[model samples]
Target: MENIIKVKNLTFEYTSDEHTHRAIDDFNLNINEGEFVAIIGHNGSGKSTLSKNLNAILIPTQGDIVIDGMNTKEEKYLWDIRQTAGMVFQNPDNQIVATIVEEDVAFGCENLGVEPLEIRERVDSALKNVGMYELRERPPHLLSGGQKQRVAIAGIIAMRPKCIIFDEATAMLDPSGRQEVMNTIKRLNKEYNITVLMITHFMEEAVEADRVIVMEKGKKILEGKPREVFSHIDELKKIGLDVPYMTELSQLLNKDGIKIRTDILTVDEMVGELCQLK
Candidate 1:
C-alpha cells in the first residue's frame, strides 16, 4: 500500500518570550492510501497540532511531513498538499463559506478554478455523497448541526482530495449528527477509496477505524489495531483515555472472574462471547 501521509520525527513547538511549549514531540507515522486511522487523546495531547501540520497549516519545528510525496514545508507545494489532504475542523460553522448548501459544497472547487460545469457536477456529487443532496438549495444556517458538518465534509470531497483529516469534527455535534458524519466518513473510505485520518475523543468511533493511535503529552504512546490498543485498559486509563463501552464492560466482567474477552469492542462481539458460555 502506498503511503498517503508520512511524518518523521515531527516536532512542533510554540515559542514565547518566557518559555517554549512543545505541542508535538518526535512523532512518526505513516498512513497508507485508503486507510481509516483514528487518533484518540485527551486535551493538550497534540492530536490537533499534528493534523494541522499534515496540510501545512503549521510547519514542523524539527522534522518532516510528507503528504503524497509532497513535502509540506515547500512553499510551491502548499496548494497541492492541501488539495491532497483536506481538513474538516471541529466546527462546521467556521468551515462553511457560502450561504446555500450546494454553493458551500462547491466553494472549494470554485477556489481551485474548476470549470463551471465541472464545479456544478462536483457539487451535486459531493452533496449526494454526504447525504445532503436534498438540502442543497437550503440556507446553510438553517440546517442542523449534523447537516452543517456534512456540508463541511461535502466541501472537502468536492475538491476530490485523496485524504481527509477530521480534527474533532464530531465534537460539536449531537449524537445523531455524529452518527451522520461517521457514516459518511466510513462510506467515503470503504466505497470511494479515500483515506481518512480522524482525530476524535469518541472511543466507539475509534473502534471502527482500521488502526487507532493514542497520543499523550505530545507523543505517540500507543498504536495498534483498535482491539489491541484498547485492550490495555489500565494503561489507557492512566492517560485519561477511555476504551470502548463494550471493552469497559468486558473488563469488569473479567475482573469479577467471568471468562469473557477483554478485547470485546462492540455489543455484538460481547453477546457472541457470552453466548459461547451458555
Candidate 2:
C-alpha cells in the first residue's frame, strides 16, 4: 500500500496566558492509500487537532506532516498538499459557496484553475458519485442536512483530491443524516478507491471501517480492525467509549453463559450467532 500521509513525532500545543496545553504528544502514524480509517475519540482528545494536521490546516509544533511525500510545512507545497488531501469540516453551511448545489460543487476545481468546461464535467461526475446529481441545480439552503453534506463532499471531490479528511462531519446530523454521510464516504472509498480518514465519536458508526484508530488524551491508544479493537470492550469502556450495540448485547449473552462471540459488530451477525445455538 502506498503511504499517502505520514506523521512522524508529531506534537502540538495550545497556549493561553502563557499556560501551555499539550494537545498532541509525539504522535506518529502512517495512513495508506484507499484505506477507510475511522478515528474515534472523546471531546478534546486531540483527534480533531490531528485531523487538521493531516492537510496542514494545523501544522505540528514539532515534527512534520507529509502528504503524498510533500511536506505540509513547506509554503511552496501548501496548495499542492491541500489539493492532494481535501478536508470536510463538520458544518455544511460553512463549506458551501454557491447558491446552487452544482455551482458549489464546482467551486473547488474552479479555484484550481480547472478549465470552466471541464469543471462542469467534474462537478456533475462528483454529484453523481455521491447520489446528488438530481439535486445539482437545487438551492443548497433548501436541501436537507444529508443533502447539504453530500454537496459539501461533492465540492471536495471536484478538487480531485487523493485523500479526504472528515472532522466529526456527522456530529451535527440526525441519525438518518449521519447514515447518509457515512454511506457516501464508504461508497467513495469502495467504489472510487478514495482514501478516507473520518473522525467520529460514535463507536457503532465505525464498525464498517477497514481500520479503527482510537485516540485518548493526545495519544494513539489503540489501532486495529474494528472487530479486534471493539472486542476489547473493557479497555474501550474505560476510555469513555461505547461498544457497538450488537457487541454490547453479545457481551451480556456471554456473561449469561449463552456462549456468544464478543466480536459481533452488527445486528445481523448477532442474530446469526443466536440462531446457531445448540
The best candidate in terms of lDDT: 1
RMSD of each: 0.9, 1.0
The lowest-lDDT stretch of 10 consecutive residues in candidate 1 is 99-108
Error of 1 at 241 (Å): 0.7
Pairs in clash, predicted candidate 1: none
Q: What C-alpha lDDT values do all the predictions have?
A: 0.95, 0.91
TM-score of 2: 0.98
lDDT (10s digit) by residue, model 1, range 46-151: 9999999998999999999999999999999999999999999999999998888988888889889999999999999999999999999999999999999999
Instruction: Candidate 2: list runs displaced more than 4 Å.
Output: none
Q: Tens-digit lDDT track for model 2 on 129-217? A: 99999988899999998889999999999999999999989888999999999999989999989999999988777898999999999
lDDT of 1: 0.95
Error of 2 at 106 (Å): 0.8
